[model samples]
Target: MCTYITEPVDLEGSAKGARGWQRIERAHVSFDHPQHAPLDHALEIDLIDGSGARVAVELSAASARALIGAMERSLERGEAETGEGAA
Candidate 1:
């Protein structure tokens, strides 16, 4: 038998030049409108694993914007699903 439990991690980081890691308090999976920020939209997401190791992920600014939009949409879907279920 195999089982797994995973929780999304809250990651944050700044740009390499004229940029730095942005501290985030929380993170949720919801599809909201994504805002495009400047800077070639280059972004790096860093998170620490259970073993206390730092991990970095490179994401394009465009991709990051898309993700935010997706998250917002997820929230929308969740609301719709729950609303219908309640009714």
Candidate 2:
């Protein structure tokens, strides 16, 4: 079932697209019927630039959770390297 809900967020990051890495200024996260994934429904993330450049990803709930965990770990590692929370 499609959630029919999309939440747009301001993003300050870069995503690799067909034209290589590009700055992404916005993102839309939603649970919807996927356009390409094998699943009937997916957690979809669309990264978009102001100049009309875009990249899309669709993941199952389990995969999305795994990815989120991986991202959290990566962020923590980065912060550790930079001594973000050290006294």
Candidate 3:
């Protein structure tokens, strides 16, 4: 079943798509059926640029959790080293 759960986040970064690097301004995160991953449902993340260009990712539940943990750790370490909190 499709949960149809989604969250939109404003972002300021760059994502490399098929056409090369683009300045991403936002992201849409969702949990639903994946278009490519070999799973019934997956965590989907779409990073989008102002011009509508986007880069997409789909990860299984376990992988998603691991990725989140890794991201958190990395961010924390980065902030500690920089002596600054998240912006």
Candidate 4:
């Protein structure tokens, strides 16, 4: 249920609706925790590059700043992954 856009929402809704979202395999997530992804405690996301292929993106967002920060972090991680694969 994740969408690639500018930034994360206020995310306050999750708090009020936390009861429902608390259960895994049904709630939205900022990123998939490697360990939890397989367990369904979090949603696993595979990025779509608009070119018709799938890729992985890693990030997390607990706040406004962290959302943006995750993007930077994800960029670094993504680049490193791409570099390693290329080599």
> Each candidate's TM vs. the true structure?
0.40, 0.86, 0.94, 0.24
Ranked candidates (lDDT, high to low)? 3, 2, 1, 4
Clashes of 3: 0
Scored by CA lDDT, what does every candidate get?
Answer: 0.47, 0.91, 0.95, 0.38
> Per-residue lDDT for 9-79 in model 3, tens only?
99999999898999999999999999999999999999999988789999999999999999999999999
Order of candidate numbers by TM-score, starting with the best: 3, 2, 1, 4
* Per-candidate count of clashing residue pairs (backbone under 3 Å): 14, 0, 0, 0
lDDT by residue for model 1 (1-87), tens: 112222355644322322334334332332222234333334544354333343344456578789879988887899888874323
TM-score (C-alpha) between model 2 and the true structure: 0.86
Pairs of residues clashing in candidate 4? none
Q: Judging by TM-score against the true structure, name the best candidate.
A: 3
Candidate 2: 10-residue stretch with minimal lDDT:
78-87
lDDT score at residue 42, model 2, on the 0-100 scale: 92
TM-score of 1: 0.40
Better candidate number, 2 or 4, judged by lDDT: 2
Q: How far in Å is the alpha carbon of 38 misplaced in model 2?
A: 0.2
lDDT (C-alpha) at residue 78 in model 2:
83
